[model samples]
Target chain A: MHTLTDAALVGVVLASFLALGTSRLTSCIRATAIQGWLLALLSVAIHEWPPTGHTFFIAAVSLVMKGILIPILLERAIRQASVRREVEPFIGYASSLVLGGILVVTAFGIAGRLPLPHQTSSTLLVPTALSTLMIGLLLLVSRTKALNQVVGYLVAENGIFIFGMSLTREVPLLIEAGILLDVFVGVFVMGIVMYQINQEFDRLDTRNLNLLKD
Target chain B: MLRLLVLAPAAAGALAFLLRANAHRLALLVAVALLHAGLVLGTWTALPPADLDGHLALDALGQLFLTLLSVLFVPVSAYACAYLSHDTGRPNRTFVGCLLFFLSAMTLVTLSQSLGLLWVAVEATTLASAPLIYHHRSPRALEATWKYLVICSVGIALALLGTFFLAMAASDPRSGATPLLLPELVLLARAHALSIPWLRGGFVLLLIGYGTKMGLAPLHTWLPDAHSEAPSPASALLSGALLNCAFLGILRVLHVCVAADQAAFAQDLLVVLGLGSMGVAAAFILKQPDYKRMLAYSSVEHMGILALGVGLGGAGVFGALFHAVNHSLTKALLFLAAGNLLLAYQSKSVSDVTGALRRLPLTGVLFLAGFFAITGTPPFGMFLSEFTILSVAATHGRYLVATLYVGFLAMVFIGMGNIVLRMVQGDAPAPAASGHGPPSSHAPSPAAASRESWFLTAPPCCLAAAALLLGVWMPPGVHAALDRAVAAVAG
Candidate 1:
């Protein structure tokens, strides 16, 4: 079980890198979907065999919503917007990959110094979560397309979910469900707004969204 | 009873989405608003028991915010009814439904007794209000909605991590307490059973996360745009009610910090952010071109003042609580009046509308009064609260904070005075003098546009009177409630 959890954690990190290096919007969306599936697997792998109903419920919901449902929504958005490549990223793909690599190193260094109250099954959990979070933030700031930014937000959310699931054992089932519901609705709302933007501006680049300012 | 306060509106909001007639939807919105207000008032006399095993309860602090939210909704709903009648370019089904859901979510924020539940409720407010901000369907409205949704969602994601850290801090083997329950965590923290490093880290993340929603500087990029672009009634609720709900989240975290003897560290960070927000607001207000945007910045400034007062502690906390009430009343009044001006003149530019007093007498007077009240001028409730914070700062010998506080207040007053006086005192433009502007898609007909209805003017008039009354006298019950709320934090 411990070895499986460690492999899933590593898979999460590699998926984030794939997302950062890709310029095709569809490829970026696929990378996030793969990360979501890995997160769902980690949810079950971190627990004992024949996991309890609570853990099983969370895993099933996340797998279906994050891995399957949200990807369909993003594909529809891009299909309607009719724009593919990331055209003009603020930071080029090559440099973003390098920065993502540096972020992983820093995450390991910081995780080594921090103290946790409880022992986890794997030592790699905290560092992997931290690295994923940093890379998500990097994608958010370096990308110009609205669709890319939404992908960045999902990556960041998945990172937080890993940290919460591993670190705290006492979180209630209801609160976890509420958190998942909020993220689903948040993405749904953002997709609708992206469609409207595509209709009004005839493009998905957020650079054109510069009308109101001080 | 507490469940009723939250669930009733949510169910009604769903029902509203299915209704087709505009009048029936409007009636449902106003009916829910009145019913929520009455339920809240009943709590003042007979407080409800904690429901869901203490996850939902109304403490002194919760009661204060819930009351403020309920009271403010009444006038805003009435104003929306009047305002929507004049401009009928689009269907308002989504607008009405989202407003009720927004109310339900904010009420949950007030009543939530566990940290995890509080985070859920606050995030829900962001999702609910996104559609409200995009009601106009214009390109600019869509831009503001997108910014509001993305920035707030990312900031809130960080807060979720912070909540986990706090749970980790509370999970000591010796304590055996539930992780995120407020009462249990506060008791554990006071006993020094929690980890200090984890507690401090969690508090900082929570501040940034919730502070982003609260419109603190450096994270307030989406506030002005969302506020100015949304229709007037939604703007009023966003400024008056929604911001306070975010502040309540921070205050809940601050309550736990106080019990852990970490108040000094938390207070210092709040004061810096508070002062920085004020400085940013002062700079932008000095040459603001749009009046609605000017009011939006003023909300930022008042939020800063609330943060500063709470950061000062003791008497300052009391002042901050009082200021929260005054700011809500005055800001809502100003936004509604601004809505009137937008309808009459068909512009938000400061240079576009002049001699408002001659054109629309009632709305013009209320606008001027709201300006004075919001700027902390005399005989307004804000003056009393601002003075309380200033005196406490001086007595504590924090001369730098005190000087900066006064300086920002003066700059805001000057900036607003110039723009407002010009708009209110000059002669009416030739086109406006005849009670009309150029016919546009959204603007009302020439005859109905300029004539101020009783529905439009009465709500703001009532708000202005409430602000004035609060300035002069505090009823005994309210005074006691304020003191209890202050003790809940200062202890």
Candidate 2:
């Protein structure tokens, strides 16, 4: 049996797409949680055959930090902000989907030229990683709300983490753990800033920050 | 030894936190900065032989940058004591502590031997300096600090992702092995150069990521706010030193690409980014409202010029190196001098403040002198170094980029000139006409205006003097070092 690890990554990518295309914020967050679970599983499997125990520790942290904790924190922020609307975005949903589609094609096209190791299970891993990354960028750029952008950044980190996971043996699992810790701090900081923005402006719109222009 | 550079300041920072003696902490701050600078200079001059944990090393590039940060920071750090004398914060200790921590972070950035370590260092610099930028706690300063942290943190995260890709590049050939050390990678790249196409992609991401921090085009939105809203001494550190650390990160990646024989591809991307930044600056400088922000945009322009020179290759690299030093010194002088004008007039808007010379003679004179020096007028190091870059550009066949560069620079000159001339030469307006916004007003008293402190004036004077000295005479030994730095890039 190939185990549920590979199947879980496939499910994660699908959930990542659903998160991108989802209209409701809560559902998107749920999809992101699923992606986090898939990532945690992926991280755990790296040590099973290779016996790199740091991988197991990192997977545990990812599960605790990303899957369970971050969603709860984001959900709490949402309740505090009380912003439940899909809200008007810079770009409409259809165009965002189109742009995200183009980005996915471009990512795989770019990845096709790289010299992949022959023995690797999925040379498509890099392309999928890049596609998810591009989708995160899409979400960030298309959104008008501050909270959505924070979610976008978290999703971007998830894409990068999954990408780095594929190179587990080469990158010393310790560095990956450090990377996750840094991302955790980044999200925590952004969340705090978003709260401040809400308190100051009485709304979640980030476009109102145009006061600094020359 | 390398660890001491970090630990000394860190220990001083903690002590400043606990001791609660402002005057004693200020003295300790200067002593620590001097001692740290001395350590960096001592190691650089002697070529001290040590590398901690192979994750940090003093290569030729690091040595050169280490020496620059050391020599340049000594005066700025000393001036900070007098600069912060005006800040009304209760725990003056936090600012002092952050200053030391900021220095430690910058030193780490210079000495980091691994790419990942360098990312950590650069990000730490961001964290350490955020509070320093918000030292005044004014609304404007708070806004600038928030923007700085959020933008820089995101940029750094993108850079971290690029590092992940670089690790993947190494993984393709070897499994469970590839230590993330620069020396090994550089050597490995030279031999297995064919497998590095993926690394080229990584470099593009790396350049864009670091370039955002370096205030290159399209991504340089945070720079003008952060620079203008920050204290003059902090602006000096940001322009003179911090930008260089980010540039050094890009240089390391460029070196890796060079070792892989992939330099040509990277150079094109840099040239485009560089020229694009200059173009954006020229477009905006024509109607710049705030004097400090105008200077900040000018900084963005100068960074573009540095990148353009680097992209040109050959003697262009030499000129770029020289220009980097010139730009740092002159830009610091300009910003510090601008600070004087801002204080005297109680406004940074060009339209609101007039007749700087009639109101505040010392600041007005320094402002004029600073403007001339920065705009590459005669008898300043900026002029000489900019000439070097132009000549190198002409000598190479980049005549089109050369012409466009000169054209855009001239436009910036006329644009900035109209503002500076109007602001500094006419009659002073009535005090009622002063655009002193309440809640953030800092109108200086006549006594303060009449007696400009030697502390403030001395730093700008020394910086301006260095620019003049470089223009008139560059000693052969210093020239030789710059030549070596240039040759290292070109080779």
Candidate 3:
């Protein structure tokens, strides 16, 4: 069980990198959904003895809402738009991969320096979670597609979710639920907005909508 | 009491959404602002008892801001009501709705005791104000709306991460264990967490994120587009209310960082950004053609001064907060006055219209007063506040810093002054005096002379008066509040 938690946590980091590396929008969305599912399993695994009902509910919402509902909404938004693929980003794919590598290493180096006394068992998760966060931010900065930015926002949020799950033992049930709901609605709203932007602007390319410049 | 204070405008907003008539909806908005001012003024009595919520409470700092916001909002709301008394296109329902919600968010920001809740409220303000900025629905306004949404969302997201790091900084303490609140974190900083490197990183992130919203340059690309694109009343609220909300967020984090023993480091960063924004403003203000956008950049300039004063500490922090109050009133006045100009002449470009002083004396005079007040001249609160900041900087042996900052401000004054004198003094633009139109014969009716009601003239005049009054006199309670707040910072 511990090994499974560790591997899924590791997968969260890999998924974030995959999210950044992919030019195809659907591939990135799928990777984010998988990350969400992994995060749900990880959220449940933090507690032994079959988990409390609250943790079970969080895991279910994470699986159903973030893992299923959101990705589908994003996919629908993608289908409604003309931008079906990322041809080339502002930062090329190869450089993004290299930057992702540097961010992961930086996260680990910084985590090792911190003096956190709790949850040393999840040491690997800490670095992975933080690295995923950095990767998500890199995606947000480098990607021009509104669809891609939405995915980046989700992945960044997933990184936070994984980090929150790592501390499930410490965080109260109510707060965890609140955080999940906030993320849920935020992604949902962003998804609807992306589709609307796609429909209104005749494309999902956020960069092309640069008419607001001073 | 806190819950009611926070929830009133929200309830009004929801009710306004249901109303059908534009006039009725706008009336509800003015009522909300008036009621909000009343509630905040009445809350002053409770200040005698020292209101706080362990982490979230109305202290001397919060009370002072609350008083400024509540007082400044009333006339702006009243003006919005009269301006929108008759309008076409999409129902004023949505505009009124967003306006009330924006009010609720500012109310929350002013009273927030915890860093976490404060962030949520600040983020909420961005979302609520988006629809308000898009009220005109032109292509340009839509584009401005998009920038405001995306830039503010991303900036605020960074702030959330910063808040997470602040929590992590507190994670090492055992006695000050469990949930993070500002007051508790202050106590924690007094002992543990002060040395934590993560805490410093958090302060830097917060400065960038909230600094972006506060219209500090480099992070201030959204201010010009949004301010010019929005309705004048919306511009007033954005420049006046929303910027202060972000400033309060930065101040909250600075309060925490100060307790963390690394306030010197944080102050240095603020000084650099402060100077950077002032430089950006000086460069832009030199050849500014668009009147509304010029006012927006002027706002950026004043915001930089506020940051510089707060960063300098001593009497400087006191003056910065006072300057923030003055800026909010005067800038709101300026934007509202600019709205009247746009309404009268149907253009924001300074080259397109001339002789506002002769064409519309009330709005012209008030706009000039706002320009004078904002540029740090006498008989305005900003002048007094700017002087106090200079005195503090010199006293603190920051002679070179004081000289450089004041010089940038003087250049700004010259740049802005030249434009205002040109627009207000020359012969009234030929087309403006006749029934001739703005570049085209078919102008929007809202731009016609019929629209220049008291709504167009009254708000800025009232706000300018308030700014002048505050500049000349320090009322008993306001002085006490500032003294206590300064003592708290210097503690």
> What TM-score would each prediction reach against the true structure?
0.98, 0.91, 0.92
Identify the runs in model 1 with alpha carbons over 4 angstroms from their true place: B174-176, B432-439
What's each prediction's clash count? 0, 1, 3
Candidate 2 residue B457 C-alpha distance from true site, Å: 1.6
Candidate 1 lDDT over B1-491, as tens digits, reads 99999999999999999998999999999999999999999998888999987899999999999999999999999999988877654778999999999999999999999999999999999999999999988888999999999999999898988888888888775555568999888988899977888899999999999999999997899999999999999999999999999899899889899999999999999999999999999999998999999999999999999999999998999999999999999999999999999888888899988999998999999999999999999899999999999999999999999999999999999999989999999898887453444445775777666588999999999899999988998788878999999877776
Per-residue CA lDDT of model 2 for B381-410, tens digit only, reads: 888888988987888878898898999889
Q: Once superposed on the true structure, which residue ranges of model 2 sit more than 4 Å away at CA?
A: A21-37, A47-50, A60-86, A92-110, A121-124, A172-178, B11-28, B87-94, B135-146, B172-179, B192-196, B430-435, B440-450
Q: Poorest 10 consecutive residues of model 1 chain B by lDDT?
A: B431-440
Evaluated at residue B18, the lDDT of candidate 3 is 90
User: Best TM-score goes to which candidate?
Assistant: 1
Interface RMSD of 3: 3.4
Q: Supply the TM-score for candidate 3.
A: 0.92
Q: What DockQ number belongs to candidate 1?
A: 0.78
Error of 1 at B59 (Å): 0.8
| Model 1 score (lDDT) | 0.91
